[model samples]
Target: MSAFVHPDEIRSRFSAALSAMYRAEVPQYGELLALVSEVNSRVLKADPTGAERLAAAGELARLSEERHGAIRVGTADELATIARAFAVMGMAPVSYYNLAPAGVPVHSTAFRPVEPAALARNPFRVFCSLLRLELIEDEALRAEAAAALARRDIFTPCARTLIETAETAGGLDEDQADRFVSELLETFRWHAQATVSAQTYERLVAAHRLIADVVSFKGPHINHLTPRTLDIDAAQAAMPERGITPKETIEGPPARACPILLRQTSFKALEEAIAFPSGDAVVAGVHTARFGEIEQRGCALTPTGRALYDTALATRDFAALPDDWTALRRNGLAWFRYRATPQGLAARAETADLEDLIALGHVVAEPITYEDFLPVSAAGIFQSNLGAEARGTAYAVDPAKADFEQALGRLVLDEMALYQAEQDASVAATLKALGLTTATA
Candidate 1:
């Protein structure tokens, strides 16, 4: 039997290749990366404890490597094919995001590693959104978009074969994994030539810019690739100085001393020249879609905490909430992973009460970085990039997660449950490592 390459290794290699490809395709993205690196370095230097904390938590290694990309697919077949492709890289679809509620005609899910250890190794994710053709008001335009989507095969022939091989063989060897990454990369590469004619493209654009992006493209070219930043505010402030045009406002919570959930900001989408097929010649046109996004992630909140967060965010102010980590934990506004401290390891304590351990300086609790995206924030990014006209339109239809899942061909794993499980497991492991038991009888 051939030795199978670990999915984590395959994922890491694929992420590196994808980042390189994106940087080449979008030069501004390369600049954005440099700016983020500078900001992260400054943050680590200014707060040495932050560096130590990340290192101790096993996150330091992956900090510079972390990234998540977003793609929009036009059909259920494409969504299912992509899901199978992602599975070979150890990524599973988690959480359903209905962008229709925010006036974007798509529902989405993020494909990412679920295991804590897998995340620590390399937390690469892809936010996959399926274009909702039903939301299009023009039946003729919708039909045209559907017909256009039906004619294209997003996956390369080799990619499809490799996906099946991996499923049958249980895994791919190193050679096969390398080939798989290359095959998959082709599907995401940007095509300067549109598959649809200029007339068809204009019709799709009239329905929605995103609709055109999905139906007129050769494949789902990655619209944006996001790099994780330790200080999003600094990154935002630095964009203009670096010759990058940032969005008017950052998405998600206002600047908090202890950031909650995920905060994202991005440079304005670029207008790129493209060629649309005409009767016998190519028609020149400009397309605006790809952009560079930066994000700072904080703790994943519990359902109760998320409710409070939603309420607070709705008010458009974060000042009412406590800014300290301890206070936030006490108020049940965040989730954290616990670990035994030096003091805890030295002392023989038989207490599983998390608060008691923290109070006694036996266990140190760190916020489990939110490994997810917020739907509103995502829609905000989409609307901002799509322009004001797109923002003005509303999709009044109720969100249909069931329909989205059916299209995806599988139900998304609950993101909250994944976070809760990681937190619980960390607590259990910490107790075992410290040779301690819970306070409960």
Candidate 2:
């Protein structure tokens, strides 16, 4: 075995550090966290079965450990470097998302741990987006934007060095990992100085607020850091009381007894003062980018479930989905991880019918949590933070995954396929433990 800090441990440390930094930078974030924790406690208290189920499924311990931060880079080089940096933390790019059709000029991917054990340790994710300069309508502005992006290197020199060391020599020793995280944090740290002139910054903002946010900044400061909540609706209702101005509406699926996919809501982005270079004098300007978000995730859905989900979203009819979990399982619309219970371990089973085993209290199936983001919900959050001017010209409805993968230096893992594999493996393992040979799914 290699003598080095485990990636999961490194990831957990970094996640804690990052959250602390954000909490310090944005005080409201701490309030939101408190609100979420309070809401979760209430929900668990009200629903003892849910609390027990979550504890059994290993979700309760990691609730406070969950965090997803978002950042927007101005170029391809930044994307590749960030991917390598995330690799040190055991995060892999999962799924490509194109927000162009939603009028946001960026394509993105979520960098997160994939394995169940690794995720259970700390499911930290960074939703990284690369600015699509090609989508810029004005050729001259696009060229200028590209030039500004090319001039800046988001990764610190030491950070780059550590990434190389980890890649070439297997892994980073404890000291190297510590230094690596400290150096890499610079890339995501907030910068108050603009790379471009005041005039350029205003012009970019006029063209698209998101574009300006990406091109004007020295580095891609994490725009927002989200804390997971067990009850988002309660948290949303509670934000205003904390002096937090939430967006008008929540994004993603409407309320459901058994929530599916992701539901998100956020407070508005703050306008921070920034200095821009203008010849011999510095010009002062304000930028709106970073915000706070709270998300509640549900079970990962199958392809058929996703299709039904898409239709329901389009039609504004959530009734298409059954709110009951058993119906959801029976319909084969959701993915669940199966485990043999204590009684099952002590008894032999003749058949592998999953429902029968579950009915007999021999097997337990827990919903697999959705670890990724929804493009539409993501775009909604971006636009809400960007204000009325967020939407750009309607770009292609299709995703440019090829361009994203090329910049990432690797193909993104399919979220659905990962869920499918996890579910299948769990079922197999559960059946084997019960001494059943027949396939249940």
Candidate 3:
């Protein structure tokens, strides 16, 4: 019997391989990585305490290795198959996002590790979107796009075999895991040769650039792979200096002393030469889609906290409302992980009063990092890179979670519920470690 390879190990290997492949495919992404590293290093040096805090939280070790990529699939079969492939890496579809409301004709779900320990080990995620062909106003174009998608199979035969093998055996051994990574990497690899003709590609582009992107490609090539940054503001400021033109405005909330949710910024998508089928000759055309993005993650908010955040965000001035960690916790605005202090662990007192413990410095509370994406932020990234056509009124379809889930073949795990569970589990474990029971204390 071979040793069972842990899913986290597999995921780490796959993420590293994917990053290397993407770096080669998009050289700008490699430059972006270097820029982010410089900024992160500077931030750590300037704020030694911040570095220590991240180290204590187990976030520092994974900071340089963290990456989240996005891809757009054209059909339900492609979506379902990719979901299975991601499952082999211990990732599940987590939250449904309807980009239609934001003028993009697609719905998305972020596939990621659900468990806290798994996430801490390797927080690799993929924001996978499935195109909504029904959203095309032109019936003829929609049908044509559907036909184009129907003719293609994104996954390779070997990839499908490996996914099934892993499923049947409960886990992949070392060799199988390496082969699986290599096979699956092909699905996201960029192909400059379009599967559709130039005329067909133009027709799909007329409907929407994103539609063309999804339907015309050989596979769902990774549109962008974002690396996490400690100070996105600094990175954003330094983008132009590094020869990278960033988008006009950062996607999420403005700079805050205590960052709330996730803030993101990205460079403009590059226009690349692609070959399209045209009779006996292949026609070359320009396509813009892939880009480099950076993110700064903040504390996960509770339901009440998220309500407050939504209310504040509704004003369209996310940065205006300044709230610190203390205020956020007092107002029930964020989820936090609790840990017993050395004093508390030594005393082992039975106390039910959390406030007292916190006030006495017997229990330390730290914000749980938000491990997900924001719908509005996601839409902003898509719209910014998709050119002016994606911003037009024609693509504004209603939000449809049910249809998205139907295509996914499974319901997405509620993001808030996951956060709440993490918060509760941490609190419970902290209390138990301190020799206190919730029933008595």
| lDDT winner, 1 or 3 | 1
State residue 175's C-alpha deviation in candidate 2, in Å. Answer: 0.4
Q: Which ten residues in a row have the lowest lDDT in candidate 2?
A: 388-397
TM-score: the better of candidates 2 and 3: 2
Q: Which 10 consecutive residues of model 1 have the lowest summed lDDT?
A: 432-441
TM-score of 3: 0.97
Off by over 4 Å in 1: none
TM-score of 2: 0.98
Candidate lDDT (C-alpha), each: 0.90, 0.90, 0.88
> Residue 8 error for model 1, in Å?
0.7
The residue-by-residue lDDT of candidate 2 on 274-293, one tens digit each, is: 99998888988899989999
Which 10-residue span in candidate 3 carries the lowest summed lDDT?
Answer: 388-397
Task: Estimate, for each residue in 1-441, the C-alpha lDDT of model 3 and write its tens digit.
Answer: 888789899999999999999999989889899999999999999999989988888889889989999999999999999999999999999998888877888899999999989998999999999998888888888888899899999999999999999999998999999999999999999999998998888888877888899999889999999999989998999999989999988987777888878999999999999999888999999898999999999988888877767877888655534478777776677888888889988885756677788877788778889989998899889989988556664444567888888888899999999988887898899888887778222
Candidates, ranked, TM-score? 2, 1, 3
Reference-based TM-score of each model: 0.97, 0.98, 0.97
> Which residues of candidate 2, in runs, are more than 4 Å off?
391-393
